[model samples]
Target: MGVDAARGLSVIGMTMVHVGPNSAEGLGGAIYGFPHGRASVLFVLVAGIGAALLSRTDERRWDARLRLFWIAALFLLIGLGLQSLDHGVAVILQHYTAFYLLALLLIPASPSLLFGLGIATALVGPIAYFVLRRLLSDVVERETVGWGDGLGDVLAGLVLTGPYPVLVWGAIVIWGMWIGRQKLTYASVQWILIASGIVVAISAEAISWLALGQYGRPDDSTDWRNLLIADGHSQMPLWLISSIGSATALVGIGLAIGRRWPSAIWPLAALGQVALTYYIAHLVALHFLEDRLRFSDVRHAAPSAMMLAVLGIGFAIAWRRYLRRGPVEWIMARPFDRHRRREASQNPRP
Candidate 1:
């Protein structure tokens, strides 16, 4: 329920970032902009946690791992098909698939190793990404992920230049795996996570402010100094630190809320459980509504975002009363279910 609650928040956050007053001035901007980048970060982190939980089995691990790879392939195909629609949104499913694949390597690692790798990546990955961008400046042809985009462009976007670079963003997923391994049912763990998150977030922000204050924020985006700013989507080390901290805090809060008042978060839990279905559904909605609405303008976008969120929550709640799995989720699980049944048939209990 806690994981679902956090996932629900991430889903809502994505909606706000996609269709709300993200760049509007004053309170609206502050409200809407809060989810920018962080929502996706949280979403990916939740995925990692889910992966960890999925692989927690005493049976042969290969089957579970194989299932994950299959799902990744599924995501890649669906993401590509969605991108072909040329919807105004940058589809993240492809990048999400990439994360799933990378996580396979660390799924069996110890919690300490996972934590160490996550921290190391958080510190070093951004620098390497920036360096590679400079090195590949003239090599890889930059293009957005969309239909008709060259294969090379799509691959590059998934790994490096896209809005969510796996190199740096992968750290969040690794940290999430670490968190997932912990005894989350304990109040001590939850409070510790909350404290750690608060400390990391504040420290990163404070350092960023001091560094940018002394060196000054650069107007030229190419300036190395820009890396000191911890704005969302900046893809800088500081931003990664801050976002990871924020994601950790969110998960902790969700867990606390869920354990304390499951009833209060029931609607969100329902929405979260069917997040994948809603994610694609909302994009489909946007595709159709694009002609009627100007999502670029916050005035129209904000209300539309709220309306979609309300509808999604209501639909999810209503759907849960009758169905356990969502439409898309059920489809995704079919192959695995069949595989398990086949194994059971072939190797019946002795």
Candidate 2:
């Protein structure tokens, strides 16, 4: 439930980043700036935690793969459909599908092993990204979103680049599994999550500052090599580290929200419960009803964001009162084996 709340918050953060003009100025800018990469990372990391939890259940092993594949297909297919809408948003469900496919082999591993591998990936993967992208410059530049873009580009986008590159993003999932293995309900564990998160995030940014200097900009010589320390430049080692820290912080804070403020948490948690439904609908709304919703412009997006937040909160609370799952979720699970679809065997509303 707490994780659900966390996911809801993460999606809300994404809403701000997507709608706003990437502000770097005032209160609106602050909202847009802080959650840009941070929220997306948290979303993926929470997904990892959710997957780990599902794998720990007694359900048939094949059932998990079947369910994941089905979900992945749905996300990819729908994401392509959303792309046709041309709402100017870079949809992430395509990358998420790739992540799920990757997780099939990973869901069974021990938490310690996952955490260790996550650390290793963080250390090595970004350097690999820089080297690989430059080596495969032409292939890397090809469009991976639309069909007929060629298989090489699609694979690269999934494994090496994009809105969320799976190689580095996979590490977040791995660490999330480690987090899932812990007794998150325990206050001590929660605080430890907060503590370790801060250490890693700060370390990444500090290293970046030391290497690049406060005002140093990305140059031809430094851009590729400096990935070792560059923050805000997605897929870099430093950025990955800091994002992991922020993701963990969100998990800790989410649990705290669940434990302390049940009343306030209810609406957000409800929204979390229907996340896929809301997420997809958000894009649809932004596409067809952008003007009606009055968030068509990035410069004036905060108001629309606020409005959608309130509406989603209220709608989720109301909808969940009557149905256990959102429409999209229920549809996704309908084809699964009956036993696997049981509430006990399912992943939470990710």
C-alpha RMSD by candidate, in order: 2.1, 4.2
The TM-score leader among the candidates is: 1
Best by lDDT: 1
Models 1 onward score TM values of 0.93, 0.89
lDDT of 2 at 106: 82
Clashing pairs in 1: none
Across residues 41-156, which tens digit of lDDT does each residue of candidate 2 receive? 88888888877776776565567777778887887787767767756777788787887887777877787788789889887877777776777765544243745546776677
Model 1 agreement with the true structure over 1-350: per-residue lDDT tens digits: 88898898898889878775456777766776889878988999999888787777647457668877988888988887887774577788878777888778777888999989999999888888767766675542334476677888777888888777788888988998888888888888888888899899889999999999999997755578867989887778998999889889888888887889989988888999999999999888778776553366666777877888889999999999999888999988888888889989999998
lDDT for each candidate structure: 0.82, 0.76
**Candidate 2 lDDT for residue 141:** 45
For candidate 2, report its TM-score: 0.89
Backbone clash count, each prediction separately: 0, 0
